[model samples]
Target: MQQQTLVNFQNFIIATRDSGYKSTASALAELVDNSIEAGATKVEILINKVQEQGVEQYEVLIIDNGKAMSEDELNLALQFGGSSRFNSRNQLGRYGMGLPNSSLSQCRRVEVVTWKKKGEFLSNYLDVDEVIDKSLTRLPKPKKSTNCVFSIQSKSGTIVLWKKCDRLSFKYLKSLIKHVQFELGRVFRYSIWRGVEIRICGETIRPFDPLFIGEGVNLKGGLPYGEELHYQVKIPNNEKKTSVVKVRFVELPVQEWAKLPNEEKRKSQITKCAGATILRANREIDYGWFFMGDKRKENYDDWWRCEVSFEPELDEVFGVTHTKQEIKETEFMSSILVPDIEQTARALNNRVRLKFIDLKRIQPQVFSKQQLERNDMYLPPVKKNDGLVKKNNGSLKIKGLEYEIVTKELKRDVFFDVEEVDNCIVLTVNTAHIFYEKIFKALHSRRINNIAD
Candidate 1:
């Protein structure tokens, strides 16, 4: 018979700590996932900075009002791959490694405390330094404790505490708080909108819908491309299992918004909303250019947006990883989704291009009207004796002009309209013979405050 040696716990813990979590926010998201899976309505994240051995360090705490674990359960929870719901399909947690794997990835020590009722708290912990020193060979057995990691206000709940956080991405608590707020806001937007409350450092987190379609968060004049498209895809290997995937397209107000100032555009995330947002189980999992087939991304694509949402059961099809930060886009997924998405993308792209052309044709007339209204405003001095010398091919040539010319493709009906100011000629062409109807008529319908709008 072959003899097997005991596994090196010290090396295993240290090696697994670097499990490739993209950032501290992602690692923290794993803990939130567990809380959500437990049916927690309220979750709180707290950060505390302290001094130890003349060195400054931080501790993280995640507390939730969920079903508390018993002493036996607590012991197993501290161990890797020891979740009771391991491989369960109905819940968010698939593998049992999220708890310990995510925790140790960011910290050298982690403690879990739970209680089913008042005065019945149980606590257990895992320390990396203790394991490496050979002083602690196994996870401490859960025992009754009067003092909890953080005071559990609820009758039954769980709290996860992280100490010796040497691997955190953000060194300052304020920076980490800002990142966590934005990340978790989008990650759990659906849940937050559905009445789940998540608080960071005593501040309630609000849902940040990336599509900007939700009430109270939409663009001022944005409109949806069309009704949402739905598709039902059967699981590759499981004949009995099927999942529904939803896709939506939103066309932002290009004509009205494209002229916004640079700072305003950046604040509104106009360029950042170009690609598709992938949501798994209503939580945004990954966002990138997906299912566009051979079409490469371009600048005009920023004017339109796409969102793809699918059920958790289709994780394998979408290639969702344990970290839940990205998707692999398996061949099967691309085959089913790319065709339709690509066609719609092409159509939207053409629509945006045409709208931009129309806007360009209409801009000169708008500027001309502005000049009339602001006639009393300051204007650059024109040199004396700058008079029209002759009319050349419907454009006026002047003596000592030194003026810049802007050309436009206008309808044949109207030759050109010109407004000379600030040593420049603002020329407008009658494109499609509807320049007045498109520009003057449209401007009359809505109020125009500034040129930037």
Candidate 2:
């Protein structure tokens, strides 16, 4: 007879927790995925901070008004890879590892309480400490619990509680709450627009449309760059079924926004929107330089944007991971979409460059008006002033023609003012521009660093 061995549950749980989740926002997204897959319309996330051993810690609770699970299903749901709907492609969750893997990755203990009708509730929990000490070998059996965080107002609902959150990314409650709201707003914008209600700490979260398609949040003065493009992609391992991937392009009002302050530009995410935003099953998975072939990204590319969205059946083609945070950019993704995306990106880049040049031409005319408003008098250069002129030396040569260089200090409101007169080029800098106010003033105002202290 051959001897058989079993895997150690405690060691496995610890190793599984380190499965490369980038942030707490991603791990929480996994829980929200389960709720959406269960046909939940309303989901609420709550965070509580308390002091333990003189140190502050946080606990997270997620309540969903979805179809609740039975006692047998709840027991199986607590186990890794135990979902009855494993490998089902009709919903968001395909791999059964999302629930436990995501919960345990951020917390030391996870408890689930569910109910089917009023006055009847069941609960199950898993604690890492108990597992490591060998006091608990498996998930606790579902039993009656009156301490459930969610009230049984609906016919069916589930509540997931995470205690001892030691691996959360944010240490403060306010930062964590803000991060969650922003991330979820983008990740589930499509679903939220379609009537899903998501709330955090009693406040509703509004959808943030990355495409700027005018739902509630959109790019200022944004317009469609081109018509929507559609591509038929064959699902991997299933040739009979084809998935339609939609590609759309949007261009921001660069002419109107290029002059914005650095802080305002950063807040608008204008400079950061340089590449394509990839959406899997209507949720944004990743955003980067994708399927652009060999074309390199340029600074001017930030004025325009692209979006690639596909169904969940093409997950393998896009190389979507179980974490749902990133994509692998496999060869299949490149072969089907690279050619068109690269061509479109180049065309958009040229258009933006021309717009910027056109805008530059108008700036000189606008600045001329500001120049006329200054009433301060300025002294003209004296005629035949030898001190202001310097003879051309052998070291000075321009296009094989040597010329004398003249420099003069002009008291104007501009940064640079240049002119050519009497076979000599004059270079003058104004002292009234912001370049002088912020930079020149700061540098010259110091009195030799207080005479070296």
Candidate 3:
């Protein structure tokens, strides 16, 4: 290949910083994702300050106890779009641009050191600054490992050290370190929570589970259930394939209703019904799509559950732009996925309505037959006189009103034929039992006495 023209390195760095991640901290998160996906049981990251010739420099070191790459694997791992995943069903990585692109986009130089089982340590470095300054399309061989700062002694693992970190221009190195620590914690929190321990500067990172613990509002009944569903569709190549989608639903505890904040509760309701997660393969693409309207915040609490997954083949249909911020819809996707997804959205919306119904204390008469048939089930109606009346035999009725008592009893049983004429309550009850006949006979006697009076 012919030598490329020298590029303006400063302008490229400025553009990358302004557009992709505001700071070096956020950029490092992409690299952490790669480590998590590499099946690392533990990851250690170190940030150290450096000073040379009276000028300040910073270095970021990352080490992982994961399956190390072979010589060929090491070379491919540094190349953009060179992925090892071909047909792995549960693979979290697909694009393969995550490692090198994410690294080069942030730092001046990227260095990798890996140790494979039954082999010597292998190391490589990409000095983007040198390449861009000299205008070389192909990078020269990395310098020998004699000067490498990060190394691994494990029989199988890897370590990456980033040097010449002039790209991260923080007011202070401490501030930059703090930012990196926070971003890594958030991005890899789930993996850390799952026992994949990761430490930054001797402090272990913990996942921030949005579900508040010991907050009376957590759903107590049971853990949510989930299942994956697939559908067949034709793509641009006229090849039929299965599209994967996962669905999860959880029931929140009843006590959580009262303690939850209004804004938090509102978000929870939407999340419970339609906290849709969009993912490419296994990695979550983004939290909400059509399910969460544009104006909503990402504060869905524990009361809600969401479904998260993606169909890898539909990446193009999603209008996945280069930045991956927004999703655009194509005609094919609009017709197929949109309808199915919208139906799921509506199902969650209906579920929210049900939660609201429970909150408002609605009448049980409106519930379905199966729901109403439960022995322990009771949908208490709106209290009469604002609950001044007492509950009698599982029914709320006004007190000191004999006529009202009779009317309530008549209405309590679903078999009663009742209608209101003017201001009075009117109803009829019929039974073939002899006790009922005797009760009416006594009423007849009392009617005669009243007529005599």
lDDT of each: 0.77, 0.77, 0.52
Clashes of each: 2, 0, 3
lDDT of 1 by residue, 141-253 (tens): 78796666466688788999999999988877889998888788878888888888899999988777656677423354557888899988997678686788999998888
10 residues in a row with least lDDT, candidate 3: 396-405
Q: Tens digits of per-residue lDDT for model 3 on 1-453? A: 988757655455445434555457545655666677777888887888788577777777888878877666677777656667633234545566556666666666788887755345678766666665656445344333433344554556777777777667476866766666644554454565567877787777655332222122223343353344454555434366655445444445533453343334454342343254455554444544454322242322334455444555656666654333345556765565555555544554455555644543442222221122232224332223433333334321212111112223332434344333222222334344343345543343443233234
Per-candidate TM equals: 0.78, 0.79, 0.58
The segments of candidate 1 whose C-alpha lies over 4 angstroms from its true place after superposition are 1-7, 215-222, 364-453
Q: TM-score ranking from best to worst?
A: 2, 1, 3
| Per-residue alpha-carbon lDDT of candidate 2 for residues 162-187, written as tens digits (9 for 90 to 100) | 98899998988899998888888888
Consecutive 10-residue window with the lowest summed lDDT within model 1? 394-403
lDDT value for candidate 1? 0.77
**Model 1 / residue 106 / CA error / Å:** 1.5
Clashing pairs in 1: 411-430, 411-431
Q: Assess candidate 2 and give its lDDT.
A: 0.77
